[model samples]
Target: MDDQPSLARRGPRHSTNLVGRSSEWLESCAFNDAPAPLHIWGVQEMNQGLFGMLDQAADLAEAGEAFHAYMMAMFGIDDEQRDVPSAGRQRFRSSFLRLIQGWSFDSNGPAGAVLKGWVESRFGVCPSFHKEIIDAVPGPAWEVYTEEKMSSQFHNNAIWVQLDLLFEFCQWAIRRFAFPGQSHLTLYRGINDVERHLIVERTDRREAVIRLNNLVSFSSDREVADCFGDRILTARVPLCKILFFPGLLPSHLLRGEREYLAVGGEFRVSVDYV
Candidate 1:
């Protein structure tokens, strides 16, 4: 916890870190990724001496910077280290390998990357909807699912983020049609970090993940059902995993949002969603 700038780098056994196989993995799989909020800073810092891209939201070099930053950050590197130049063939390949390894990009990376890729190709924007989401959506209407503010191992002490699938879709629809009305993508709260991540409910095999902070919260199970027309928590088990926590969870948790915050930690009752 004392080390902010310095990060723990695990030189997993050579078998655990397969550079060549990893490259093959990334090369074969479909890539869909967005810049996590923390990654944005990393990319900007790294791309400083590189591209003079002016646009914050649209430029390709900026997008590449953001992507590379995310790749570096996944390797447990500090944000500043994210931009180390990879001009050489070996260095570029190694750096890229680190990302493949972090993603466990064996056959497929995590769902977040796949989904973000979809958002990118379809909407032409990254999913780090920091301001864009709040701007387009009205606060009082629908549900507002905001991320929790957290400092932990997996998430690397970064603030949390959520994706309201339905709301995001609504936002997409509005933008695609150039509709001048508003966004159904409001904010939602409830279910602390653990519960938010406990269920691996699938939208599909490709988009099976729904972020805890990004979904609407009902005071009870009935509420969860009535609001989203689906069940996130059982009516009787209103607070299930949300209230209880663990230390070092399943390896699957190592991927996507679950990995963002180290999964294994003692329980600390959560009171707020950022």
Candidate 2:
């Protein structure tokens, strides 16, 4: 068995029953001493499903039970039927406890260097970032995994999912930040970490409000109308870049009628899609 992380290029090996699960290896890596391993962000569906269980729940504690089923399917955390180590059997317990506790990655410090580099490559921009809130940046890392493993649609809905996740995560974080006004943002799927968001607002056309992005309700409707040629420029996310973040995003893309997650800026605005 490989005891260390491989650095050299290796071809895909045939499946084996004995290969150690990364979850176990990750735990063995001894990073557990850090903050709780955070829950998956951009899981609007999971949150929705959990909400559905609230009424069925016997009490407040049992409300989110159904949500665990998805987690099991996605992460295989509860697959005890396989003949594996006793430590593996205890996997579910540890993972379960970790879930309720909440986790985080130290992005600004040395530990998050890998993640920062990964994000930069994915988005072609170094994030104006902080260490503690790496999870808040929202990437589609397991979107494809979620769909294939669970047969759910998540790709098309990624923009909103990440946006909503970050918006909500920032609520409880109590961190001070300046978003620096971005117009275009690139998204990435984090294979081992949260995907990245490239906020592209500081462009040459910063003054020309040709598009009033729904992502940001920057100006009043009248002002936006006055700036653009068409009175109502519909704003939408950039689509070509969707395929940029590989993995689960492109594999299990979201489908019909469930396009957006409703990011309201409480300002009347227009949009321009590329």
Candidate 3:
């Protein structure tokens, strides 16, 4: 067995009220007293099915339970029949409790770093960039759609699952990060091609928007800007912004989409593929 601290060891419990906090804040508070190996093997074991639970969660309490189940899955805890002995199971359960209680908005701390790295390793997009895109949106009327939920025709066979998991992580990261009075995320599945384009166009016209594609591996804002050539134009929408994945040829465009996809006055806009 590993010599690291067993899940039985007690640590500071996370608070239930996490509405205003960032992901970084949550991680710092939760793992403040915990030792190394915050990157456990079980976290990778989480699949898309388990992640979908977040969307279906009815309330914070239900969300908390779903989040706990996610962590338990990560910890390799068997939900069926309690594979471990009673004492061990209790320790695992206690540890999972601490884990979920610690969950909050902000992803800049040690735990956040672990999660970010995990996301990057698994999904191929930078978590920080993803967070920035989310933050750039206007009044939080945005919704997250997973590939599993999207139409089969729209799914990218190569990266559909990864995209779904990426959005899942994004949803998990931004749970309580929304501003007060902001609306909850609408879960979208079975969106058609036209609907996807309209969603992008609507978001761009109304508020700031950022759409991420698998074609690009984003590390910094500079890379995002460079993806577009000298054709950068001033955005009509005040704060609206869109990011296209790299490697897409300038000629490639989504059907019913404008030539330019980027939408911020301050930042250069790129029009490539959605």
Candidate 4:
């Protein structure tokens, strides 16, 4: 068997209290260690039925369909019909597809908050930034962050289950494509300002420990990333931390930048101001 240090050796229940606190992320989560050895991100005990279908799929397309079907079941939607109450009681559609779409349209909006909140809950990592900067110490910014998360999730009851399955699907894909013993993906993000981010430590003039938002967008292609801003931040992202990536779903659902949604924690990154 492969001897990679599987981070899923033990299952830790989602930490409710630790959500959205960047200052406590490195100390609270097990991800502060070396990134290369981690295979699963603390999810070994997830219900086998929740994502086992992915393991049996013939290809990525089949896996995507299987996940879509699973998502529909969570919302009580099927080809024939869906229960009104089970469908969620709100203006926004509670479907996982819509959530990702909403985030793509505006990462500073309600959908983005919900996605970040979910990562905080499941991974014990904190959202380093939301509509505004966030920290471990509660303040007005924390209040705003909490409010957005609550309001969005209130409309999409039980939607977290869909996200849970999504993460499982992503991990399965990572495992499939992580061939020849490679365990990390080099990702880049273009931003307008570097100071707006939470820099935990400066290892050198170009490298530092960055506390990324609980859910952040990154691109595999450097040119795609450069289109976003004048500054670029690049890092070697651990496979276990990626929640969603291009081609993981239908191209229509995930467009622009060949984006990947990365779950946050403290990570060493190189910054470039161009």
Candidate 5:
């Protein structure tokens, strides 16, 4: 904690631009808050068994293939290759997988901003960082992030709703099969330095609450996580927080480090200085 930036040094600037939503909504969505993970679309959607087809799959690989096919059908992506090229079909071709791939390449880029904006709209969790610190106040940083989001969504056919459904599918799959009885998974994130992280609240010498970006990557495998950085951030991440995981899709998709994409908020994490 001594090596970390003091809250006073990185406190909110208190802007009134109305660029982001309140953090209170984020707090309420935490796992400890008796969160309704599927509150967005509701259990009724899940009950319709859109993903019940997964039950017949023998393993993760097969399930992934089936899920992918389902997603393609859901968005009418196959229609893109058909006779007439309508505006809707072209837009439907842009997918959540493409969004994540774009983000993996550059988090500060346009795709990253769209992904972050999706989280902010759905979870009410403001992004803490873009290319620069997205301070609490409405300022240049917010404008930069907002501009990227707007531009990306404008040019890319606006797949925001698709991303929402993707998240819903992921959450449903996680609860139904990935970790059926588990409320949280112990996830790890590798980091170059502790100081680079936003430590919002210090609970003690060993623990602190850090405000994560609206969408951040973590790993279920400690060894895979350590390969990326000198330090490790360990947290008990809620199943609801995860947007996607390596096995959630085909091996060809979301490749690298066995990553898990999780929604960001203030999380109490323990840092390993190794």
Candidate 6:
């Protein structure tokens, strides 16, 4: 693997007026309690810079009107005033619900299928269909698809969900470990600085590979080498693979309990004190 940062770049930048308009829409809809169709649509537009065109409008109200018209066209709702139901509107609402409900942030989860299908259809470019091109080119088609999909608004939301879960795990770890008042902890996005540390790489939505550095402070060099069945002094510790459900975990091993902090009812870690 290349070992590059995994998370995608932040959403596109927008003018202050456009941003204010989005905020105003959100407040008007009172979408504070849960995810709603309007909220999701607005967020997707904002991320893709679709709202930037509103800057050409005379004022915020004009921009809002323009946006509403654009939305109506995009959703295939022809009438501006008619409240009557239509097939196009029903399709739009159903599709939006599926998009929201089937969004599993983890690539290995069930929602991945829905996300993949949506991306392929929306872009009209299927990675699996490009086998010939992929074989003839320098880069992998799957890789390209992965990159593009991860950068989409749907994937961005998934990343946000993972980050939220991670934040909760960190809080649990801090409370469980009972660290000293002055102890410092840091969270790295895709890499860590400590030479002697444990790395938990997310292999899928429910699986991760934990590699312990040979020089990790929690274990002696000899012990680390023994774990790998290697006589070399610098041999890397063998990876310990783990599988987990989203909100549940298997019981911790007796050995693990002595060495690490348990978090989120699933993840466990041992950090080197800086």
- Cα-based lDDT for every prediction: 0.24, 0.24, 0.27, 0.63, 0.65, 0.28
RMSD of 6: 19.0
Q: Which residue pairs collide, candidate 4?
A: none
Cα lDDT over the full model 4: 0.63
**Candidate 1 lDDT, tens digit per residue, 32-114?**
12111111113334435323322242533343344345434544444433333334543232232233233333212232233
Best by lDDT: 5
Which parts of model 1 have CA positions greater than 4 angstroms off? 1-46, 54-93, 101-274
How many pairs in model 5 have backbone atoms within 3 A of each other, for residues 3 or more apart or on separate chains, i.e. clashes? 1
Q: Which regions in candidate 2 have their CA more than 4 angstroms from the true location?
A: 1-51, 79-127, 130-274
**Candidate that would win on TM-score:** 5
Over 1-274, each residue of candidate 4 has an lDDT whose tens digit, in order, gives 0001112112122444322333344332335444433233434356566467767887887777776676676576443222122235435446566677777778877878788777766656556566665543377766787788777444555767667767767877777743325567788888776665556678899888766665678888888788887877788777767778877864455546678887765567888976
TM-score of 2: 0.21
**In model 1, where is the ten-residue run with the lowest total lDDT?**
1-10
Residues forming the 10-long window of minimal summed lDDT in candidate 2: 1-10
Which runs in model 6 stand beyond 4 Å of their true positions?
1-163, 182-226, 229-250, 253-274
Pairwise TM-score winner, candidates 1 and 3: 3
Roughly what TM-score does model 6 have, to 2 decimal places? 0.21
lDDT, candidate 2, 1-274, per-residue tens:
0001111121112132111222222211122112122223444455665345433545322322333354445444444412222353242322321211111212122222323232222222222233222222333432321222222121222322332333332221211121223222222111111012221232232111121111111111333233323222233222211111111111111211112211111111133321
Higher-TM-score candidate of 4 and 6:
4
| Root-mean-square deviation (CA) per prediction | 20.5, 19.9, 21.5, 8.2, 6.3, 19.0
